[model samples]
Target: MLSEEITRLIGKSGEPMILEVERGAIRKFADAVGDRNPLIWDDEYARNSRYGSVVAPPGFFGWPVKWDSPMPFFSPIREELITASIKAGFSRIVDGGIEYEFFHPVRVGDTLVAVAKIADIYARETKGGTLVFSVTETSYTNQHGVLVAVASQTLINR
Candidate 1:
């Protein structure tokens, strides 16, 4: 079960993080995933595609790292939620699932801004034990301020 403090964190958004969609990063991600799509690796092939440039594969959102900031990529709100969940007796954690909605292709050289928020917190009872679930929703926008994608991830804690 979630306590009041933990539940209160729901719907609270974290600070926005900027991520540059570099060509190398996109290629690397595709390689790591064993995706050999020409659009991800061949610039010329991608140039003729509808996207008009090298594009990131599905689920290949850019990383959020700040070279100058002392703070890590994760926002304070996320850390707080984890801490509170642990305090509430959730010891083990597992990824429940992830759902992504893409409105546009993520092309190389495009800047993406991501903002994450705790969408919900709840608990369920099973034969093993009570499990707490937290849902996080992140919205990604392009440099032109166009909403590009939205990803929702669920985490389960026991």
Candidate 2:
């Protein structure tokens, strides 16, 4: 139940936050996600793959940088966005779906920055009433600005 004004305000552009992806971080994400892929854990197997090095799980590319900084957004954009939606008065918000496009394989020790933007917002009338759908797109890039992956997530607010 975000106020219309606040929703509009949230639609406005904000500063892009930087997130560094490290080796340990990727491994932890793989473990948390319950994806025990050899490419993500076995360096020997990874070296034999097309990537020629340790390749992170495709979904693990979204892991964020956990630095001791005052800016909370530097943590994880996905979690922050969901928390913000709840705080904005949404009685319940669920992750509807996610789509990701991979341009390059994310490897261990790759420092990446995730730049996120509100891609779209709309509402639909359902049996439960009007539900708002918010789509956010995040692009992951390495320190050199090489695009690594693009992730689009849909959140359903009711």
Candidate 3:
């Protein structure tokens, strides 16, 4: 179980992230994921389609990470949640899974704004120990201010 202070952090959001979807990046992602869809790569094919332009794949939302930075990606609220869990005596962390819901089409050259929040936190007792589950939800909106996607990720601490 989490303390009141930690529980109070539910729904607290971190800083908004800005991401740009580029044609090259989308194509690279599609190739990396072994998806050879014409809409994701062939500009000529995409231009003839209804979108009239290359559209990003269903799961492609952000650009590739630059590894030169000292820190990977920082989320203050998420860090605080992890610290709280550690203080609660959890030593091992495991990634549960992530679920994504797309509302609008994400296209190449579109800029996306994403904000993530702690949605829920709970614990379940098992034979080994208590497993604390933390769920975070992120909302992705395009430059037009239209909500494009929502991703929920779960982390378990044991």
Candidate 4:
């Protein structure tokens, strides 16, 4: 029961936003995830590994960064999807799950861009009530256009 306008808005996926990877940001993200892996925190250890420099954790790519430009229409893509579902007519909503596919390690000093899209939308009737779900897929690529990682998140509505 989402309004057509809101549905349309949510459906419009914006262009990818580019971001620069910083050593400090990577360390912060590692700490936030409580991952103290030497590969992420120690340059000496990282240099000897296959990756010549410190690399970010797979989950670190999901971190948000401040941009100088006006924020995109779908500010927080996940939240926008949930709000859109509510506006359409769903009474309750929840975060169903997230699935990630890593293509390459996010290395320090690599400039990356996040290109996202609404991959799918569907509804079903359950014992609890009617449920709607939206799947948003985001692809992260380095400046060289190399695929880095892809994250698919599902949002559930009831």
Candidate 5:
């Protein structure tokens, strides 16, 4: 069961955090994921492609962030949400899923601003146990003010 306090947290929006997209970071991430796609790390290959330049893989959109200063990244927005849940008498938390809508490709040297908001909260009874789900919506915008991507993530806690 979910408490009213937690329910109140739903629809709460957080400040936007700036995420720098470096070409090196993109290449390293590609290497780490074993994704040998040249378009993701090779400028020459990407130049030959329609994109005409190196771009990040879709998976980077869901990269994990840490609890830092001024603003919070949606990927790790649960930092505060987890605190609220624990205060609401929840103990464990796990990722349910993520749904992403990409408007533009993440290119190197692009700095994006991401804002996270608690979209919803609900309770469900499963064969395993009772679980509470928190849905968060993270919107990403580039320095050009272009809406780049939006991610809806569901977190399960018990």
Candidate 6:
């Protein structure tokens, strides 16, 4: 059974992170995702495109937070925040899905600031198993203070 105190832990926030998008990172991601788009790797190709210099692909912002490093690490900010909102005893945790809305195009050299928090917590019993669902709403803004993206993650803890 989940405790009331833990259930009341909704709205708790985790450490905020700031990330800087880099050209190399964009190229790496493009390659990893099997995107052979010349614009992502070839400067000459991207120069003539509407986005100008290499632009990051959509969902690239879903990657880790890198302040100045060439490559970012999975910080698990959403998972950590959700953990604090759930009581002990969950056997498994899996990502249900993420609803992401992009407000601006993420470009190389853009610095993004993100904040993640536990928005809701609840539990239900199903024919398969009893599970707790934790939802985290994270909003990312650019250094210019303009909202860049919002990612809502639903985690199933069973």
Models ranked on TM-score:
1, 3, 5, 6, 4, 2
- lDDT of model 6 at position 114: 78
**lDDT tens string, model 2, 1-158?**
44564355344434565665566777788889888888878889988988777767786663544544454543344455556667766659777998999988777777777777777767778887878787878778887779988888788987
lDDT at 117, model 1: 96
Lowest lDDT 10-residue stretch of candidate 1:
67-76
What tens-digit string does per-residue lDDT give for candidate 4 at 31-117? 888889998889999999999999988856634455543433233654566667776678586778989999899988888888778
What's the TM-score of every candidate structure?
0.92, 0.76, 0.86, 0.81, 0.86, 0.82
Tell me which residue pairs clash in candidate 4.
1-88, 2-88
The number of the candidate with the highest lDDT is 1
Candidate 3 Cα errors over 4 Å, as ranges = 64-74
- In order, the Cα lDDT scores of the candidates are 0.85, 0.70, 0.83, 0.75, 0.78, 0.74
lDDT of 6 at 123: 82
Clashes of each: 0, 2, 0, 2, 0, 0
All-Cα superposition RMSD per candidate? 2.2, 3.7, 2.6, 3.3, 3.0, 3.6
Write the candidate numbers in order of decreasing lDDT: 1, 3, 5, 4, 6, 2
Candidate 3, residue 56: the lDDT equals: 91
Candidate 2 residue runs with Cα over 4 Å from true position: 1-3, 7-11, 66-89
Q: What TM-score does prediction 4 earn?
A: 0.81
Give candidate 1 misplaced runs (Cα > 4 Å): 67-73
Best-fitting candidate, scored by TM-score = 1
lDDT of 3 by residue, 1-158 (tens): 56776688788998887788899888888889999999987889999999889999887786623323333343567778888888878878889999999999998889988788999998899999889889999888998999999999898998
In model 6, which range of ten residues has the least summed lDDT?
66-75
lDDT of model 5 at residue 94? 86
Model 2, position 110: C-alpha lDDT score: 76
Residue 85 error, candidate 2, Å: 5.3
